[model samples]
Target: MIRVSASGVNRPDVLQRKGAYPAPAGASDLPGLEVSGVVEGGDAAAMADAGLHIGQRVVALVSGGGYAQYCAAPAGQCLPAPEGWSDAEAASLPETVFTVWSNVFERGRLQAGETLLIQGGSSGIGVTAIQLAKAAGATVIVTAGSDAKCAACLALGADHAINYRSQDFAAEVLRLTDNRGVDVVLDMVAGDYVEKEVGVLAEDGRLVIIAVQGGVQSAINAGLVLRKRLTITGSTLRARSVAFKSALAKACQAAVWPWIAQGKVKPVLYRTFAAGDAAQAHALMESNAHIGKIVLTWGDV
Candidate 1:
């Protein structure tokens, strides 16, 4: 458990609120998915093994209940907050960071010198993916809904940014890569985007879809899959087992945490609303007007 300081507002939270997604059975029904706070109490043996002590500051990913003044998260899901970051910034890291690390590196197997295309380049997950990919010595191309959002992605170290509204992203990706296509695509918008994502992949390329914001069902060319040896995969983090998430925590602690310490990565917190103003926060998220993360803060936290 933690004395919650701030809570991250993710698209999943919005989906849960509208009944489009539900908390997995035996989990908290509250909306927040991530939090940053001080350790208050927990199972002693578990906390010790997790390298946590009472009063230590940490950020955690949770299934729900992060919006409250206190939240209980599995010990293995907690990570020490990076030094010198504010509550809001730290609050925003766990969900997006965990998702990107698991999907882009673990599932997609992106490696140095590969080219990656990221959908929704200005989202919480998108920004995290861009920096992590670049830091890992991979090239990054991203697609956003507008020019400003595209600029935001570029400024975050994306090698190229496509304004999806002004450009056909698949064509642009091909053109940017000189028709060779990318090695991997970290996708949030699945549905129809899946076909084009498959189209713009090099042989042995991987396409990891983390969300179905566009829709779940998609039609893709089996020939491309066969010829390119493409791998298409997708996952949601909320219902995964504690053992899997614990391993992710260890991976991030070894890899991404050091990057954060070196300033190679930084959390992009677009805004924070008072806990009481959560409705407005959710509205901003659903409007898709923010370029980075949105967080909710508790009283005086």
Candidate 2:
């Protein structure tokens, strides 16, 4: 159990609220996936693995139930909050960081000296990706809906930012890389965007898709994929097993936590609302006007 201080709002939460996405079997039907709070009780083995003490302030990724003052989470999915972070900031870390680590580093296999192209770079996931990829020694490129959003991504250490509304991202990526193309593409938009992303990869590139914000059906040219030796794959975080998330938690601690500690990467919190106004939080998220993360706060912090 955790005495919840704050909860991170995510796109999936909005979908779940509208009855578009259902919780996995046996998981909570509540609309949150991550929280920050004090530990109360959980499996001893998991607590040991996560190095969590009963009173420790920590952030955790959960399947649901983060809207309340007290919630339960798997111990293996928890991590110590970074020093000097507010409850709101700490609450913002788990979902975005976990997603970035699993998809960008673990799945995409992005390495130092490689280039990464991120779709929707002003988002919670996008901000995390830009910082993490840059901290890992990769050149970062991103696309956002507006010029201001593009500028925000560039300010966050993206090497280049394309306003997707006024610019052709594929062409810009090619131009930026001198036609060599990026080595990895972290994509949230699927459907037609998938084909465009495939067109912007270098030989032996990887494309890791984490969301289908556009549409679900996508068409790709098999010949291009074959010629480029590209890999296309994607995963959703909520349905994975406890052991799987536990492994990911360990990996994030090893690879990503240092960056946070060193101040090389940090959470970008847009706004926080009282827990009673969760609907407003979701509305802001759906509006797509805010940058970084939206959080809901409980008073105990």
Candidate 1 lDDT, tens digit per residue, 1-44? Answer: 89999999999999999999999998999899999999999999
Clashes of each: 0, 0
Error of 2 at 46 (Å): 3.8
Worst 10 residues of 2 by lDDT: 41-50
Best by TM-score: 1
TM-score of candidate 2 relative to the true fold: 0.98
Task: State in Å the error of residue 7, model 2.
Answer: 0.3
Q: What is the TM-score of each candidate against the true structure?
A: 0.99, 0.98
Q: Please give the distance, in angstroms, between residue 262's alpha carbon in candidate 1 and its true position after superposition.
A: 0.4
**What are the lDDT scores of the predictions, listed in order?**
0.94, 0.92
Residue 174 deviation, candidate 1, in Å?
Answer: 0.7
Q: Which candidate gets the maximum lDDT versus the true structure?
A: 1
Model 1 compared with the native: what TM-score?
0.99
Model 2's alpha-carbon lDDT is 0.92
